[model samples]
Target chain A: MNPLWDREILMLLGGVVGLLALGTTVGLVLDRRVTSDAGRAVVVNLKARVRSWWVMTAAFAAALATGGVGSVILFGLLSFIALREFITLTPTRRADHRTLFWAFFVFVPIQYILVYREWYGLFAIFIPVYAFLFVPVRSALAGDTEDFLARTAKIQWGLMIAVYCVSHAPALLMLQIPGYDGEGAKLLLYLVIVVQLSDVLQYVFGKTLGRRRILPKVSPNKTWEGTLGGIGTATLIGALLWWATPFSPWAAAAIALLINLAGFAGGVCLSAIKRDLGVKDFGTLIEGHGGVLDRIDSLCFAAPLFFHVVRYFYT
Target chain B: MSLETLAAGALTALTRLVTGVRARWPDEAPSTSPRVYFANHSSHLDTLVIWASLPATLRARTRPVAASDYWDRPGLRRWLALRVLRALPVDRSDGCGKREALRRLIEALDQGDSLILFPEGTRGDGAAIGELRSGLYHVARERPEAALVPVFLENLSRILPKGEFLPVPLIGRVTFGAPIRLGTDETRQAFLQRARAALIDLRNR
Candidate 1:
């Protein structure tokens, strides 16, 4: 009964070893044989990933640096970048220029500042109430009536996608749950890890063994085998990491299932948005990562649900 | 040597490389001597993109004019404006002060530096071209020797916009219009109208 020798931790360790072995073997095989343009894309993707191992390692090191709050801030900056990419693709008018400016400069700062200040009440209402009112008022003052409704709605949509959805990452600080005395932030990290891992795993599994397309138009990369296997594997990892969360290993598995499922849907939906916008990636800030939005599409859906689940069950 | 300009140049080059940069000028031979380069503003990054697109020799002799209030905010901005890009500031609010600022601009032309001006005076949404302000006409009137070149900026409004903190990776196109000579019989309104027409004409072409 060693404190560190819990069944959960042991299970996660085994899973991690299994994933690394599987991913590396397939990646190496693909690297050797890729010839066509599509095949070359896969090969390049694999090689780039292998080269970025240090960057990934650095990311983990930085995540563990400031304990949990520092990790939260790191993810917060990521969400800000992702949200900025989302709205930049969407068309806006001169009438909404001032409001859009405030959205970027004022609102974004206020939302993050609230999280930094630990002002939960304000953060909760900042977007739904304050943003809703402020945007229309600013638009009305512009005095441009042509397409006023469309203009105002566009502004709101930008806030919803960029601020409201992305802010949930930092909202992890507000969770006050029993059983996990001070491990609430750790639980937040666990959820993000599980969700992002699910995404990466699905891609790996799909690329290596995919023959049947899950939904070709919405997300050509997704596959049935990847969906089922990725979620199952991620759940096993989540079940093993239950110590970080207030839930039992079984409950942790269930939560992981929900996160993976929702995250998959999010990725598909955002990809569709990109397709409709007549673009590929949201932005080129991240090399090989497409855009910030491309990276965080899953988080937009998973963060809020994860936050609420912990709040409901543990708090 | 200034950090902001150096960083801004690097960022702009990176953005252009990833997003596929294209520039089109209205006329084949752009006069290298003294010309007013006017463009539509959509993002703060607009200045860097236009500046970077210029050839080295022209870039060395070109000065981008920015607002004094914004450029004067911090040491970094000031250094970038004063030292790196060598920008001349024109006060948008104060009429008399703006007149004095025009003198400085004239001085830059006298010093053999071409000028870049954002005619909209502020950032606009990426939807369509905004109304051209009359400031360009004033500059044209004062510096008749300076050819007025209308520049149309596309996709920039959508990339960074006015208030968004991060830039969206999108291809931005800059079309530089041919030089428009101000006629002796042209009124201020007529001169501004002709300048706007020149920009619109390039955008269509």
Candidate 2:
């Protein structure tokens, strides 16, 4: 059986709740102090973001408490909603209908089920091998060849990223690291906590000191000042939280650095796609986050890389 | 809620979840005074989606007009149409003529029940709204007081296309436009064209 309880996990969760409370307090104070139209707008958005953080933190803490099953179900649901948002924007025609149905109902659920069953061998290749082959063959049977290759490719890509890649985070629950044993919960929490904090820190630093844009053509909000500030701050935090994991403080920082870089790459790529599609947000499900996809954009990119890295050296 | 009510509630929730349905009505609030919501026919999911998306207060009073040949057939199809949707099944090929079908609709409106209708009379390829069938025109004439709400359904065609049971999970939206009443001086062609235009206009917004 997995050891789900640890003092470090509790303290970490408490630290998050406390920081969110502090941010909310600061936002409320700034609400009265701010002047000018731009300042007022920024204050209002900051308050909304802080409010969303409180609710999101509470939900995440509850899921973490229930151990692996809770985390698996939570991430599984994220993949489903993320995939839904991905397909919603793509230009799918009439001929792709049945094939898409299979993707959502059959493929998405099956990939998650593989993670649940801990069939790592099959889980690794289900989307890339099985789904990749199945999507095109089934679509061809419909006999509509106009944009046939493009249509099948879009569906396959959606599964690969949304379903397959995202699943690896929860699939962290399946990692059998020698002495680390069933402590996959800590590993997942570390990845999520480090990645999310990096995003928030990047925004904060960017607002205060960022002047140079990293990629203005893709996402103007991302700046070099923000990226460097976020990476440095988050890596330090990851190093400090090393007691919960099997890694040394140095190893934790190294992995955190890798996660942040991967997260940045994910954010840039997803931002480009959203711009291409001409939409600001994926859905209105999350208040400040825009959509589930918007919130998990970083996770989608970083999860596979982090999982493989941990599985390689530790397992 | 009773067992039947529970089932209906579950089905409604499930339908909304499967289709990320975003419904936006015009700023002017929809009139609760027994109105006819006539939308375009695309896939089998059309009626269920429109019906599911309605406010619960209006939903109880509304009955979707479904084809008897398709909906009233035996097995799960009939159960869903009769039990879940509580549809008003109109005989598409009435041996006694179209008046009987028209009479039943008017009677439902007379009894203070709102209705969900498809003016196209049949499913289309979801390209342009097909030429408005005369059934809607006649209904507007009979119940001139009932608001003829033009509902534009977008993206459902790709979600469940014609003749496919399995549905893709795509974001679908239902826009309910402002209602217009039939003018006494307006001819059938003019009224139908105006209604068709109303529905098409709701598409972009």
Candidate 3:
């Protein structure tokens, strides 16, 4: 069999199978204890998640069938919608409008095109180097002299939110983890699955045993009990999935904890952004879920950190 | 559905629940022709307050001419304005005279519709009323038969500033001034400044 298929594949499949088993068993047992309000919320969230799961699962299956280019295109669409939501909330001035147009129209497309072509070197520098210079020139052409620094910073931020942070998902195809020959796609799947799992677990744990509010002002939903419990559970699952990844079981567990922690921080920080923008949720892009930003805000934070860690060791 | 009274009722309800709603109107009788109710710009909520403050019968005959570019965007804004509110549109970027858009307004007025105008042109920090743009004067001159009602929108700037997207829940008042008739030889600039003064006068009162 393929070297990448040795144990990590089994680990992932096994871990998911095991978690589903545990989740269903525990969910049924705990049904009696949950309050009506909390139970109702869980049902609604679970249903939405189930819907998203089927959709993502279908995409995952499609990625496996179609290979890198197809998967990259899927992620590019996600980034576009997420970026649109980000810019919609953060106000841009008339001066930066042209810069924003390029960011949206030109830079994002070019970045994804680089991924499609698998030009890793150019893909890496496209946003940071080329788009960086181009945006400023566009802003300068507007000739509106007020708030120059703020205006420039806003354009930079728009790029960061819309393009750079989102580009990490597609960047996964560039990875060459030894022992995982064709498993880069699986790694991407693992990353998304783990990060989203951590998020969902935290919410579930927090609602159940959570007492003291962690940060009521920013996101009233977070709680210390939930954080500790969710991280613990996710780490355990991560360790179990070590069979599917290039890492050892312990290393997998450790990475899971890091991703979980980072994902939580991402959610909280984005919540603060929403609060600043005076919106309850980002744009109403998703039906039950708030927006594209709301869905991937955690991914934006977790992706870079996860990529760096995997690259540092596994490579 | 009288847009203003409906708006006023909603504004009143929202203010009562959060901060509180207050209003003022022109002391004189309603004009037969179209009048531009010009006031200070402050919050997104400013338009709602002015629209809601009109009398029911008069509200039916009035339209708040909003920017076509902004309100025309898909989503909640378009839904509320086009479907529920029925606001008119004026193109801010058009180089040609606003006569085309104003003609639409004239049609509304000719059909016995009045209108609300933001003389400050756009939203701003409500520290003091900003300089009046000449568009209001043009509109007023075109419909000389329409009485010019100066309205002062108070405390709205603080409640929702220009850069801020969200309204800080706070008490705001909309004050309407007495109707001012345009003179046969009144300079557009003179009439515009005097109309702006009426809004400024209500800030303290």
All candidates: DockQ: 0.11, 0.76, 0.04
Please provide the root mean square deviation of candidate 1 (C-alpha atoms, Å): 7.7
Per-residue lDDT over A107-191 for candidate 3, one digit per residue giving the tens place of the 0 to 100 score = 7788888877767789877888887778777878879767777767766776776577777776776788776667777777688
Positional deviation of residue A151's Cα in model 1 after best superposition, in angstroms = 2.9
Best by TM-score: 2
What DockQ score does model 2 reach against the true complex?
0.76
Candidate 1 chain B weakest ten by summed lDDT: B11-20
- Winning candidate number (DockQ): 2
Candidate 1, overall lDDT? 0.73
Task: Encode model 2's per-residue lDDT on B1-205: one tens digit a residue.
Answer: 6665777788789879878887889745756678899998898888878888888878878888888888889998888787777788898874675788889889999988888999888899988789988899889998887788889898888888888887787888899998989998999999999999999889878
Q: Which 10-residue span in candidate 1 chain A carries the lowest summed lDDT?
A: A1-10
lDDT of 3 by residue, B30-97 (tens): 54456777778877777777766666566656678788888988987886766556688788775774
Q: TM-scores of all models? A: 0.68, 0.93, 0.59
Number of colliding residue pairs in each model: 0, 0, 10
Give me the runs in candidate 2 sitting further than 4 Å from their true place.
A1-3, A31-44, B1-4, B74-84, B94-96
Checking candidate 1 for backbone clashes, the offending pairs are: none
Error of 1 at B95 (Å): 22
Q: How far out, in Å, is residue B97 in model 3?
A: 15
